[model samples]
Target: MATSPAAPRAASGGPVRLSAAPADVAALIMHEADLLDERALEAWLALFTRDALYWVPADHGDSDPLRRISLFYDDRSIMEDRVWRLGHPKMFSQNPPARQVRVLSAPMVEASGADTMSVRTKFVMFEHRLREQRTFGGVYLHELVRQQQEWMIRRKVVHLVNRDTVLWNIGVPI
Candidate 1:
């Protein structure tokens, strides 16, 4: 996608200069959700950089994933292992393969640098498995870097609305 040197309103309601347009940013985000919805785990993993970090903080206020307990704090290697396990035929947790659909709001460019951009988007994901349905809603904070002709995720933080509560099995990537 081509990017324009325009500023867009950030999630905090302030304008930030960015090399990417809101539409371009939203397109990347929507594509990621679509990949997950299609269960294209390998393709989804390809959206991140080699040193990517995926985090889901246990609490909304918690910072520093290293010092705080997180629902998930996975680096690229861990993500690779997870992708393998999720695809393994004998992975009991994914025996039936949970179905997921994610709805995301338009992405807002919160900040940007020469080769990187920070974005925030609200999301709601619905998962169905074992005859049960669960809904997860949250805000997603993404640090994206321009790689070649595409944007690759460097860090992704999922701030779940129910972060403080005990959650059911989230066998698949969120």
Candidate 2:
């Protein structure tokens, strides 16, 4: 892919114009949700850039992932392992794979640059397995970067509302 020149910024250090339209941004977010819900792990992994980071903070107040304990923090290598585990038929945890449905609010673009955008969205996910149902709600913070013509996730932070509390099995990706 041909690299585009860096976008100009305003005096306040913000992008003067967004690289993607709001609708496009929302569509990407929705597509990601669908991929996860459908258990299309490989396709979902393709949405992320090679160096992407996926994080779920253990505490709402936690900042630095390296210094603070996180519920889940994964880079490309870790993500690949996770994908493999989730897809493996012998993985007992997923023997009777959980059924999940995610509902997301409108994604709001918080910042934009020549090739990057930051988005925030609220979501609630319901998972059912082994005759038990679980609900999780939180915000998704995505840092997306345009690679050629497609937007890829550079970082995704999942802030669970009940992060600090002990939770049941989260066998599937959130």
Which candidate ranks first by lDDT, i.e. highest? 2
TM-score of candidate 2 on Cα atoms, chains taken together: 0.86
Model 2 over residues 1-174: C-alpha lDDT tens digits?
Answer: 101113346899987653344888899999999999999999999999999999887776567889988778899999999999999989998779999999998886667889998887779999888998888988888899999998999999888886667676675678
Q: Superposing all C-alpha atoms, what RMSD in Å does each candidate have to the true structure?
A: 5.4, 6.4
Worst 10 residues of 1 by lDDT: 1-10
Using Cα atoms with residue i matched to residue i, what is each candidate's TM-score against the true structure? 0.87, 0.86
Question: Stretches of candidate 2 above 4 Å error?
Answer: 1-21
> What is the per-residue lDDT of model 1 for residues 1-174, given as tens digits with 9 covering 90 to 100?
111212455689887454334677778889989999999999999999999999887876777889988888999999999999999999998789988999997787777778888887779999888998888888888889999968889988888886667686776778
Q: List the residue pairs that clash in candidate 2.
A: none
